[model samples]
Target: MEKSRVYFTDMRTTENSNLQKKLARLIRKAGIGNIDFEKKYVAIKIHFGEPGNLSYLRPNYAKTVADTVKDLDGKPFLTDCNTLYVGGRKNALDHIDTAYLNGFSPFSTGCHVIIADGLKGTDEVLVPVSGGKYVKEAKIGRAVMDADVFISLTHFKGHEITGFGGALKNIGMGCGSRAGKMEMHSAGKPYVIQEQCVGCRVCAKSCAHDAISFTDKKANINHSLCAGCGRCIGVCHRDAIKPADDESFDILNQKVAEYTKAVVDKRPCFHISLVVDVSPQCDCHSGNDAAIVPDVGMFASFDPVALDVACADAVNAQPPIQNSQLKEHWNESGDHFHKVGPNTNWKVGIAHAVELGIGTTEYELIRV
Candidate 1:
């Protein structure tokens, strides 16, 4: 198989060129303009950092991408589905508010922020995966599937569960509707934290299967009846409901790739990953840890799999930052993500994606 082309550009800039301008140049050189953006609805998938996490990509990067799409006559919107976990972004309204709080407002990004899933996280479109093993029909956010083109703007960083959160994680896990997220993350249903549950019956009201029951002013979920739609998790006011994080990390990675395939299939797709921040855990965390390594650079590729591999390789080649998480967990493995997050194998997702014909792991890095 031929190597996929992945483009790179450093963070350094001249007086006339800032990071945002360099980002614009990188994507164009990577072939973003090859897609017919004229009059199309383009979904620029992104993670608007959790309320307190400072490691997510800034909106200025997103603005450069959005502006480029607009210049090509495309209608662009920044989007991400509701997270399965209970947080500031578990539902559309709170998610949008959080996006705005994190500087993803229309004014900042030159595009509106859309919570791909609707208000309660139940608005979804079942998208079939052509060569899926873990996910046959992925439940994607309706708005994401509704887009004519898909672009992933990822913040490449270490992830506790998946080793790293790169393009595949951004597209697959980020695009899934709440139920879809539940499926990838666990085989079991969400259980309420009784101490945190105020017995407001809010969760019970959101359950489509009537799976939640209250006793002694505490909520409990009937796993047998629960479809794991994850609506209750979104509606909880006290952050009482918790999605089960029981899936083995390998399975989680493979499922993430399958979900990504569901998202980008049949769409004109492009991907860009910013390797700045280099945090030791997911941006989903309300707090970010110190960088595991120095910032690498920005990467772009038409092939998501190749983009991810290129980013991971670049990170692994860097020396771990002193006293950072990577140095703390230094191992003989020589893989930075695995050293930081030993239990997970990030390669599982990349290998599975290649098997599913997502893209080749082999890549040629083109410095832009």
Candidate 2:
């Protein structure tokens, strides 16, 4: 396999130089300017932190990226699909409100925010994954697929399900519409956890299939009538509804890679990951835990798989932060992400991505 070049820059900076300026330089050095952005719709996929999650990438970083695109005459807009889980970012209106609440406004990021999946998370495009093993047709957000160019501005962090969330996670899982997310999470359907159920009837209101019923102030989902659209998961404020995490981690990882293939295929794409925070869970959560490891740096590459592999390797090379969640089982197997979320295997996704011809895991780390 040919080695892809993954650019890196440490967090160390003087008053004369800051992280934002370094990010711009790193992306340019990694050849972001090579893509013609003139008058083109460029979708910069990013996670607008779940309401209470403080570890998400700052809007300032997003502004730096958007400004860089605009410098090359690209029409840039920050975007992300409505998450499958109920949270501040479930629908387009609420998603935008949460983005603004987190300080990601046009005034802040120098670009507009577009919720890729529309009002109900139903606005999607069925994209054919050419070499997909798990998914033949990936349902991606229409706004994301419509862009002439795609860029992933990912906040690298650990995930309860995927081990770690990186460039691939941001593009594959993050770009998936609500129905698309359901397909990736399970081969079956979603269910309501009655204990957490507030019986506000919010979930029932979101379900188009009339699968939800309330009895004794608790909501129940009838599996036979449920379409598994996953809108119910988005509407429940109490987090009572959830998709089945029944698929094995390996299969789940492969599906993520296949979903990524559907996203970036035949489009000019660039990936950037900031490996700070090093949280022990996905940013989709309401709150983030302590840092598992010290901040590594910023990484950028045209290859999503290579970028992920490089970031993971860098994280593994660092010592765990004392007293953080990682200290509980640090270096049990020399992989922090796995140790943090033992049920997950982050490597499976990258390997599958390589197999899908998304990019090579073998990368040459180039410091700029």
- On lDDT, the candidate that comes out on top is 2
- Candidate 1, residues 6-68, lDDT tens digits: the string is 999998989898888899899999999999999999999999999989999989999999999
Q: Which stretches of candidate 1 lie over 4 Å from their true place?
A: 200-210, 214-218, 331-333
Off by over 4 Å in 2: 191-242, 331-333
Task: Please provide, for model 2 over 127-173, each residue's C-alpha lDDT reduced to its tens digit, 9 standing for 90 to 100.
Answer: 99988998999989999999999999999999998999999999999
Q: How many pairs of residues collide in model 1? A: 0
Name the top TM-score candidate. 1
**TM-score per model over all chains:** 0.94, 0.90
* Model 2 lDDT, residue 234, Cα: 59
